[model samples]
Target: MAPSDPVVDPISSRLDYDVGELRRAELAADPVAQLRRWLDDAGRAEVPEPNAMAVATVDADGRPRVRNVLLRNLDEAGLVFYSNRLSAKGQAIDANPVASALFSWLGLQRQARVDADVEVIDGDLADTYWANRPQGSQIASAASPQGEVVADRAELEALVERYERDAEGLDIPRPEHWVGYRLVPHTFEFWQGRRARLHDRFRYRLTGGSWEIDRLAP
Candidate 1:
């Protein structure tokens, strides 16, 4: 093919979402509650890794980074996920102390957004969760120096093997750098896709000590 050869456009592959309407009457007074309901729906629909979400953070340099992480815990307080304290996400959270998380359940034609303040949960909580993780995962988390460059896959595997040997006949402890952080949400948005590109969107904002809900143009 020539350098100037035209590339095929994949515009023909598109979807028309016709999910059910998101009515105000069906929404929970609390955004967290409403989000929980949607999460349940996602699980019931058999969406793979329903708890997975995309988290976005800004670094000290004012640049943004986004990555997918599993939602380890959720409640009225906020959403929680675990990571290495020295990882890029951790460093960004350290610098900005705020983040936005997005949960997309495309099969259900729905998405939920969370904008919140970040806070490190207590070490005890982190330890408990760590203890519950599979032995392999615990060893891998301990072995990985996340966001740091390695020579190659071979080096990473070697490190994992070393950790595996060390963890033999012992409970692998959570590394000091591995911990959980909670996002205490100040605002939330739930979007439901509809036919013809028009969608239903709602925003919930924390005002004073209560939450206020409003419909957003989509």
Candidate 2:
């Protein structure tokens, strides 16, 4: 019998809508402030996992990888998250030192995209965040070998048991391989959905250590 030809899927059609009817009064001056407002609103709405975002990183060879990670922290300096330094995402960031973050708050019909340069945070900062984690999470961090393939689930379970027994009545030290990183934003774009698809797009770019905001075509 002849082998069947490989099947390919076609891209979906793009949706069209008027993007000019959205309100821009709040986004006229500073995009960062507007982002903060939206984030606070998202929290007030009790959106499930409001801090969850898709983080994209590139490898040394320019291959891109994306995954969902909890937004551990955020500020004007940048956004922060923790991971095992030896993990795939960590290694990719180490090699490329560039990343992008996307936040989609569908309930609010808002999205935010951030393109940034990444750097591993200092040991002291990582330690401070580690100290704030729940005891169980700290224990799990010590036990699990993130991004490393194991024999099976049983193997991981065994490791967890051993670590738990050893950590009984004691503090689990943060592993050297586990730490936090920050992405310093070079550019940010804010999108707001509107009636009749007339959305609002505002972009802020860093130029000469200052931010310049501009309206973007939706």
Among the numbered candidates, top lDDT falls to 1
Give the Å error, residue 53, model 1.
0.4
RMSD to truth, every model: 1.9, 4.2
Q: For residues 20-95, could you state the per-residue lDDT of candidate 1 as single tens digits?
A: 8899999999998898999999999999999999999999999999999999999988999999999999999999
Q: For model 2, how does the per-residue alpha-carbon lDDT over 121-192 read when each residue is reduced to its tens digit?
A: 999999988988999889888898897899999999999899999889987788999988898898999987
Against the true structure, whose TM-score is highest? 1
The local lDDT score (0 to 100) that residue 187 gets in candidate 1 is 96
Count clashing residue pairs per candidate: 0, 4
> What lDDT score belongs to each candidate, Candidate 1 first?
0.94, 0.84
Model 2 segments more than 4 A misplaced? 1-22
Off by over 4 Å in 1: 2-10
